[model samples]
Target: MDSYRNSDARPPIMQGSPPAMVPPRLDWDRPPWNRWAFQHIREILPTAEVWRGTGHRHRLE
Candidate 1:
């Protein structure tokens, strides 16, 4: 059995180092940098759930 086949396996990204040698301000939609940015999206772009009402249920269209 291959080690990579294990369910716990997490493949190394950018050979297990930070994505760049001298990190530029990331474009975030490009390759390489996009990989790291996407992994940490929750930290970069925070979100909140909006409560519509307490006693009313909204119908889905």
Candidate 2:
């Protein structure tokens, strides 16, 4: 498995300004890329904020 982290040569996916790799929009959710895609879903897909009335207060650990 390729580390979600960058390899010796290149930066991690989507790290650079124009993005290092944009795996086809159709397969952005596929194996190798899904790792990063899932973490940045709001940026990758069109998402609207839901009114949950003040989301989780605890900062990410």
Candidate 3:
């Protein structure tokens, strides 16, 4: 990583400090199996779109 830094682009005064690392958003460190379970459940029971209310019962002749 040190080779990537250029003196012309970056000043030599900031060499003492290390680069900052960003943490994962959703606990990526966990095992893949745990993540797969959550993804599958969402697909099985997806939200439904309700168009109309319950219709009234009709009388037979």
Which candidate leads in lDDT? Answer: 2
lDDT of 3 by residue, 1-61 (tens): 3565554575667565674333344543356644654555444345666666688867788
Error of 3 at 12 (Å): 8.3
Candidate 2 RMSD to the real structure: 13.7
**Model 2, C-alpha of 17: deviation from truth (Å):** 9.1
Worst 10-residue lDDT window for candidate 3 reads 20-29
lDDT of 1: 0.62
**Steric clash pairs (candidate 2):** none
The per-prediction CA RMSD against the true structure, in angstroms, equals: 11.1, 13.7, 13.7
The local lDDT score (0 to 100) that residue 55 gets in candidate 2 is 60
Q: In candidate 1, which residue pairs get closer than 3 Å at backbone N, Cα or C atoms, i.e. clash?
A: none
Model 1, position 13: C-alpha lDDT score: 60
Candidate 2 regions off by >4 Å?
1-19, 53-61
Score each candidate by Cα lDDT: 0.62, 0.77, 0.52
Name the runs in model 3 displaced over 4 angstroms. 1-16, 28-61
The candidate that achieves the highest TM-score relative to the unseen native structure: 2
Summarize candidate 1's per-residue lDDT along 1-61 as a digit string, tens digits: 6574686756676784654433235565467767767776665567677877778787889
Estimate TM-scores for all models. Answer: 0.31, 0.47, 0.18
